[model samples]
Target: MQNIIEVKDLRKEFKSHSSRSGLKGAFRDLLTRNYKVIPAVNDISFTVTKGEMVGYIGENGAGKSTSIKMLTGILNPTSGSVIVNGMNPHKEREKFVRTIGVVFGQRSNLWWDIAVQESFRLLKKVYNVPDDVYKDHMNHVIESLDIAPLLDKPVRKLSLGQRMRCELAAALLHNPPLLFLDEPTIGLDVLVKLKIREFLKEMNKKYETTVLLTTHDLTDIEALCERVVMLDEGKIIYDGKLAKLRSNWGEGKQIEFQFADIHVKKETLDPLLADLDAAWTPGNQKNVWIANVRNDEHIISEVIGRVVASNKITDLKVHEISIEDIIRNIYEEGIING
Candidate 1:
């Protein structure tokens, strides 16, 4: 496979000012300024080859967006290098951007007052796409995204889901070789997310477009990516195949504990399985809690025994631990730092 992205020792830092409380501190600030250098991306490095969909995920304030900004030539790193499609992202920005498509979830690239079709036309001209090529790709994307009805509507008039479909169409107008998606399905409904995921899969298959996706939603990664790069506090903690991560988690069983009290604290349940290879997190419902416990008869019984003794358990259900559960555990516990 050809390498589309090459990042080596990529680091980005920002200067933060220190503030103080009272009049004494205000007077201190008049004479000398205090600055703290914070590293947003601290000596992290990774690469993506052509046609690969890789997920870059982490918690909030984990530098996922910061890294994306640097990769897209929007921000210059304090040190190190970034090369995309054989061009420096920062130094060769004008040329480099031509080979890549970017879709930020909260931001729109389309002109708000113009019709979606007009934005597509403008993009075609901006990227210098041939007329025939533009028409063919435009028809293909509009049909694939089911956005034909939205073509005549202004961008601001479209709903979040409708605008998202248009946003996707806009990004692929020029059919760039590489795509960067940041939370592409962030605030959309489940059906819309499914539609976007299917479209991404088809586009990847149809065009062999390399994608670097950064999302908090693990389901997106589970559905679209075979490999993932996990980050924490601007550092690369785990980088490898998602299947391998699940395999190493062993045969664990997920037990959902439903209680009468919605105000139950996790700290009360964690200590029961402290000595075992287990993790607990809040379930979809407030009164329900889920735990991934090792698949040992004795271990499972010990956990249930301890918990049942303390609380009035309304219901208990056991099932196979899912990939989402393992990834969520990593989010809370940092279990796969190696």
Candidate 2:
């Protein structure tokens, strides 16, 4: 495998202006200008091999967008270097633009009044794609995305899901080897999201396109990317296999149990469930108790045994740690301990 994108010690900073608060504060801020240098992206380095799908994930304002902007040549790095497709993206903007495709979820790249197919045609002309090649590519994308019926529909008339499909097709029509997708599946229903994920997977397999995906959706990362690069506060915190992240941060298990009565305060039950890290709360306004047991495999059995020995139990259930919880734990506590 060859490297398609290489970033070395990349750093980006932004000047922050003092924010106006009340009317008095606003007037004062206008009179006296103040600004601070905020590091949007600290020293971070990574490489993407040809045909690899890499997930870039982080919380809001965590430098995910800044990194993507630098990669796409929309912004220059304050220091370090970025090479995409054997060219420095900032120095070779024209040549690099032809080899890469970008899709921003919050914005539209298609004309509002034109039909979806019209947008594709315009893109073909803009990219100078050959007639035959454009037609074949357009047809393949439309069919693969199941947007055949949507071709004749105007961009403004289509639903969000439909519009998103067309946007993806528009970006991919040029057959760029590297694609940068920012929240491609944002704000869609479960079924539509699944459809988009499947489409992306098939596209990668068919075209061998290298993808750099930035999204807050963990499902997207789990379904599409084997390697994940996590960022926080403009710094690269974790870069490794997704499975390893799960194994390390996903060790804790959650157990929920309902008891017949709240005879014992949750505090009292804590002593009996000392072997397991646990928290007990009132299940509802009722007398039943709900206990959240953590890090104990025999949590249910132990709770059952303890309740049966002392009181009575009605219902019990246990669930493994979820990916959301794992990521949350990582963000709250550093991954070194989480």
lDDT scores in order? 0.89, 0.84
Structure candidate 2, residue pairs in collision: none
Q: For candidate 2, write residues 74-148 as lDDT tens digits.
A: 999999999999998988998899998888899888999988888888888888999999888878888888999
Q: Give the TM-score of candidate 2.
A: 0.87
Which residue segments of model 1 deviate by more than 4 Å? Answer: 257-291, 296-316, 322-324, 331-337
What tens-digit string does per-residue lDDT give for candidate 1 at 1-338? 79999888989999998977699998998888789999989898888999999999888888898989999999999998988999988899889889999999999989999999999888888999999998898898899899999989999999999999899989998999999999899899999999999999999999999999998888899999999998888999889998888877646888899999999989988888889878897899999998888898988998888888988999999987777667766777767554
Off by over 4 Å in 2: 19-32, 258-269, 278-300, 304-316, 336-338
Q: Give RMSD to native, each candidate.
A: 3.5, 3.4
Return the lDDT, model 2, position 131: 93
Pairs clashing within candidate 1? none
TM-score of each: 0.87, 0.87
Worst 10 residues of 1 by lDDT: 329-338
